[model samples]
Target: MMSTAHMASDSILAAATASMSIHSTSPNTTNSTESSISTPERPSGIDNCLIETASGRPVVPRRIVNPIAVAPMVDVTTSHFLHLCKIISPNYTLYTEMIHCNALVYHPDDLYNFFGEPWEGKVVQLGGSDPEAMAKAAKLVQDNGYKEVNVNVGCPSPRVQKGAFGAVLMKTPSSVVDIIQEMVKVGVIIPITVKCRIGVDNLDSYEYLYDFIKLVSTTTPVTHFVVHARKCWLKGLSPKQNRSVPPLKYEVVHLLAKDFPHLTITINGGFNTNEQIKEQLELVDGIMIGREVMDNPMFLAKVDAGYYNIPAEKIKSTEEVIEEFLEYVLTEHERGTPNSNAVVMAPLKMLYGGRRGKEYRRRLARAISPRTKSLPDIVRDVRLMMQEMDYGGVTTASEAEDNGGSESDSDSDLDAASHSASGCV
Candidate 1:
């Protein structure tokens, strides 16, 4: 069911789309299509968190209070993970893992649980270079209640490379401009942003990044840019290596802030502590915490008090928070989704991170079967472990299995990609 405002917007989208241009694929795309994309009607009444404008008109919440965001890591920043982070620190912004625009534009029906109907302010990031598809996808994101839509231009995975998007798009800023322009013109009500690397491949110079930002920001209405300080290799290096091998030159990002004072610039990469984040926030508008936060979500429990100036009493303890997430698992399981345990456990296991958490992590591994442990048992075991003051993780059932691919493959992509129309980035 479309809202009156939404139906009117789509009418404009279909009518003006004819004038849009489709440039030749930028060599990275295996195939290119200029098909007219149609948006789906999502259930309305989703703007529960929308803020009022000066004119009394409603708009999506564009200003993140502290501006700190959780980086959208595929297979990691799922809605559940973001929800967990939200519970831990309500002020820090959250993002969904980058889903290709094709998924929302083509297989919208199958993605009922993909992004989740976020009632809180959250951003959804999409991967693709097609303007019409990007616009249509943005509409769907708005329709489904995401507060913001973000374009992904930082992923260096081989699969993303083959799709002609992700880090490769850094070489095709024109395509990104076209994509964002269409999204804006299609009347997406939420703010649109881009998450990109400082540089890519041979374009690893600061001037290249500066020029890229100038071109994109000057042309599109996008005002928020998240710059991952590391430059990624589109070739030889695997995604894991790309994240580690590239030395993060954060100074380049700091210079971006110094030069472009108006744009809200966020710095990402290698930041692991509140001390590090607080130090960087003095130079940048915001800081994006990645694997470090995912590895130990408790790292964010103080975000409200430290950054947003919220009182400390409102903050929940690590034990209480994990209990809440475990409760979420129990509630979600009641819905009878086959992958409920697996899906919830994926992020839950990471709750107890680092050396002391090794024992607890091992127990969690044994708890999940091809079937699964009872929800109550999982809760009880966690309580027992914590009651005895152990929050161990990383070491697994056999000290070999769940070491994050040390003993087995981390091929969970198949499960997510099955619902992906084109693919997951």
Candidate 2:
């Protein structure tokens, strides 16, 4: 409901107009100048919380206040990444990178290490075909305290296809049912869900798609399906290209959801703007944001406050979040794990998105590259360079120097101790 006057102002004004549209309340509905979106009435029983698909499988939707979810990016959605996400916005249902079922159940220690605390209310994405392997993994996840277990049927990587998993699973609906059923039988009390593509390459027909849904539903009635609205070209496309090249067919997903009224569907793929997210929120039960969430990590920070009417801080500006992360990481470094790459690099990288982040990104990429210097030097020099750039507040070279010295001293001490012990032996 933006008038001509409001439309001409700025992007935030446009956003404000778009956000207010969610509730579609009267134009007069404004509280302190911020528009409020109305949430659906709370359901009576736990049944209301569960996402039951057309097939009748039930997955308890973890009561997500925000419709936003971070898409599971391989190598990126690790425990450390999920922890960082919680720091920025606890509203999101953080997803883990696809866990190989065989690896997870067999190497319990590795699986435990990967399932970090930020995952307490989050979902684990599993990749594998064997029902027993998947079921065993799901039981392990259930025991380890994951809120949800997701079967990944949309990844298009050659590495994954070689193993007859990921996007390839979409072609085998019966197998998916077996996996889901086995997980349920093994006492996976939490909802088990699926992230799948619209269809595979040439087989993107309504019948095939309907059959896929029906088979999974019959065996496991869990309704939380995150459908990336595209047909993955599994043959020649690289995983990255597969994500991009597949033209988004949101209608196909909408059609499926319409036919299967019982299921809760979240549409994904090519949705990058707030307007798009807001629009999709109106259509689907939820929205899984991928690159968009990465670029604008603060996007979901307002969901609880704005949409769900829960108390949440206004979305912090990129600079503000960066400042807080810098302080937190510095504190963590001081406590221990000073040299941990995951701890050090992640927050710094996250800051290089949204408005006015290009220069910082350029400088950081150059500083972190091996062509320039070692990691320790990169950390020291980059902090100094960022200071020179006058990012938010200036950080002094003296502070960077001190941090570098402490790290060097610790490394030296460890090296000396190792040498001494070896000589004594």
Candidate 2: lDDT of 265? 82
Q: For model 2, how does the per-residue alpha-carbon lDDT over 32-57 read when each residue is reduced to its tens digit?
A: 23222222122122133345555333
RMSD list, candidates in order = 12.2, 16.9
TM-score of 2: 0.68
Residue lDDT tens for model 1, 1-425: 12333343344334333322333222222222211111112113223343544422243333446567787878777767777877676767787888999988897764446776565558888998788998998898887766888899888887888889888898866677778878888898688889998777756555556656766777778888999977676775667666666666777787676566667888998886557777777677778887766656666754555555555556665656767777877676675544555566666555543454555556555555443566667667656666676434221212211222112223342233212212122
- Measured by TM-score, the strongest candidate is 1
lDDT of each: 0.65, 0.60
Tell me how far the alpha carbon of residue 176 in candidate 1 is from the true structure, in angstroms, after superposition.
Answer: 0.3
lDDT of 1 at 266: 86
Q: Which sections of candidate 2 miss by over 4 Å?
A: 1-64, 118-120, 299-313, 326-344, 353-356, 362-388, 393-425
Q: What are the clashing pairs of model 1?
A: 356-392, 357-391, 357-392, 357-393, 358-392, 358-393
